[model samples]
Target chain A: MTYLLLFLAFLRVGFFSFGGGLAALPLIEREIVDTYRWLSKPEFLELLALSQLTPGPIAINAATFTGFKVGGMLGAFVATGAFCLPSVLLTLLVVTFLSRFRENPYVAGFLRGLRPALLALLLRVALSVIQDGIHDWFGLLLSITGGALLFFGKIEEIPLLLLGGILGLLWYGWR
Target chain B: MPERHRHTFLLFLTFLKIGAFTWGGGYAMIPLIRRELVEKQKVLSEDAFLEALSIAQSLPGALAVNTASLVGLMIGGVTLQLAFVLATALPSFFSIVVLAFFFLRFRELPLIQAFFRGALAVVVSVIVLAVWQIGRKAAEDSVDLVLTVVLLGFLLVTGIHPLFVVLLGGGLGLFLRR
Candidate 1:
């Protein structure tokens, strides 16, 4: 029963999480944190950061991690499989039947409409992450400087995360 | 190994390597896919890859997973698609499980908490930048701008589930002909 719920929950995440990994944040937060109470908000944010810091897709990471927490190794596999199932099924559907789907005007219109709304969703998430994630002056400074660097330069994500980790150790470890 | 089996195994290995090595997420895998599949192995032409990317983008689910599935389907069919999905997802599945194990165990440690805080701070910045970059391309016109604001207000003010909000957005789009 627990496994089934996990499957259903993540399946919803897979089907509804359009756009990509970042766009999936609010939905994931809803199902996993608010709906299921599987992970707290702080833990969810940590999962998000960890997913970004590591390799592969964020959705997959979230599924596996949360699944492991809820049910164990088997749960992890179940959740992860549920998350990937949509892409596999949808990919097959598009390839076999709807090759011209993207070129369709109505489809284009729907996507164009979906785009800005998605932007709004993403913006709301960004604001909340900032609100929940930043607690100290150092954190604010780090966010501002890091965001500036990312916007201005070609800097990659891992290195910045690594630098942040080191700065954290220096600042918080001693104190 | 038989020739066919070897070929399938090699294809699986290619995706496994791509999955394990690439950081950031699905978008990050594109260059590697282009390099390995398009340029190196000659699995598919550039145009085909682009088309696959478009199709992948159009679909729901992870962009990386969707693209990999399409490429796999193009190369071999359902068999390769299944294999590709497994290969692509396995690395992160294993990596995160291990991380989660350690994270749960040592999460209360001061050092871990500090690192978590620090890392999360940077993640906040990354997300802010993503909003900026994606927001620019997302709003194509004044109508879109208004829609964004309206949707955001609904999301923030109302207690409506985001799933419903997403549906409402799509429903509005179909009618608006945006």
Candidate 2:
């Protein structure tokens, strides 16, 4: 039952989560935490933290982690596979069509209209991250400093990300 | 070189690099994509860059994957297009599978936890930087800024699903921007 639920839930996430993994969070939170009772709020939060820490999409990570907790290794496989399946199929279809209509003006115009909306969506997601991740003054300062360095200093991203982690350890460890 | 071959090779190389380094999902991929597509490939001009960014946002799947697919289609032929999508997605797929395979063992490592904490902080910073850059480019006027702020406020306050906001914003952009 849990495996089936995990597979179906994640399949929905895979299909409907149009923006990205971060955009998928509220929906996942609703399903996993609010609807399914698979994980509590704090556990969902931990899952998010873990997802952020690990590689891959957060939705996939959350699916795997929650599936494992609920069922086990099989759950993990089912969840991860279900989560990614839509993307694979959708991309294949899009590619197939694009191969033919690559020059169609209507397709181009639709994409043109879609662009601003995408920008708006990305901005919304970024703001949500700031809201959830930065919980205190130190965290806020870290975000600001990091943002400034990346924006104004034009520091390479790898180093900037590494610096944030180091600062997290120093600040959070001492506290 | 034939344009198709050039685009395909570029797509493969770009996504391979993104896959290798990007952790913590799509936001992390944004700057890298910007660096490569806009800065390196120069496939998209400033206006087109903005357009691609918009499309990637409104449409679905992973942002990195979506951006790669569109850019791939635009710059390269179908072969390059598929290569770019694969390149962007394959890294995350492998990484997650590995993590899942070693789930129990990996979960217990204190050092790993510490590393994650450090990396997460950095990821946040990287996201912030991305927002700042995107805002500078995307918000060209007061209307754009208002739309951004209103949407932000709506999300923060009402806890509405992002998809709805995105749809609403798209309608607003179409009606207002034009």
Candidate 3:
């Protein structure tokens, strides 16, 4: 039953989550926190923190962690597989015929329309992450400083991520 | 023996490299993929690269995986599509398995916890920057700005599901954009 629920929950995410991992957050929060009562709001927030820290898609990390928390290793596998299945299948279907219509103007136009929407979705994701993840003044400051450095200074991302992790440990540990 | 077969095999190998090395997923893989395919392979043109980016963003699943599959399919066909998907996903799958095996034992270590904390801070910064970049590119006109503002407002104020917002945005794009 746990495996089934895990699969179904992530299957829904895979099928309907149009804008990738961050875009999947609200739905994930709803299902996990509100509907299933699997995790508390704070717990979900913590999971979000963990997800970001991990080395994978935030959504995937969330699913894995949630699944592990709920039903252990098997749950994690089920959730991850279900989350990915829809895309794997859809890609297969789409790619089968995409070549033929690669040059179609209508296809081009449809895609052209998608770009702005994608951007909008990503921006929404950014704001949502800030709201849920940044809990304190320190967090806000860290986020701003990190964001500014990346945006203006064009600092490479890996080092910034490493620095943020180190700072989190030092600040939180001392406090 | 067909050229298509060779292309598919090549797609598999290339994506395998992407999946193997990419640490953070989705956005992290973007630059690496851009460098490899656009710069080194020269498989996709600039316009196609932008189109792929747009499509990948609008689709479900991991953006890196989705983008890789799209590019592979475009260049090498159905076989390549399967290969790319597998290639992009394999690393995460294996890594998660490894982490799960050890997480219970190590989840409580103070130093490890501290490292994760620091990493989380960096993640926050990375996300903010990504949002800013995407916003700059997406907000082209007054209509685009309005749509973005409205969407952001809805996300913050109302608890409407994101999927609905994305659908609505797509419809708005189709109807409103010239």
Top of the candidates by lDDT = 1
Q: What is the DockQ of candidate 2?
A: 0.30
Q: Give the TM-score of candidate 1.
A: 0.97
Expressed as tens digits, the lDDT of each residue in B9-80 for candidate 2 is 766887788866877576777778778878887876766556555655545556666666666665655566
Which is better, 2 or 3, measured by DockQ? 3
Q: Top DockQ: which candidate number? A: 1
Ranking by lDDT: 1, 3, 2
For candidate 3, write residues A1-175 as lDDT tens digits: 8789889988888876665666567668767887788877656655655554456676777777777777877887788778877777776666565634535555444444555555656665565556666667877787778888887876767777768778877887765
- Candidate 1: residue B99 Cα off by (Å): 0.9
**Candidate 3 docking DockQ:** 0.43
**CAPRI grade, predicted model 3:** acceptable
**Chain B vs. true chain B: TM-score per candidate:** 0.95, 0.59, 0.72
Off by over 4 Å in 1: none
**Candidate 1, residue A67: CA error in Å?**
0.9
lDDT of 2 by residue, A1-175 (tens): 8788988888876665655766566567767876799887545644655565566556767777877777776877787667766665555565556444424555444433333444556665455556566666766776777677766777766566666667766666554
Residue-level lDDT tens digits of model 3 in B26-80: 6787777788788888988877777777667655777876787677767766666
Model 1 lDDT at residue A105: 78
* lDDT agreement of model 2 with the native: 0.63
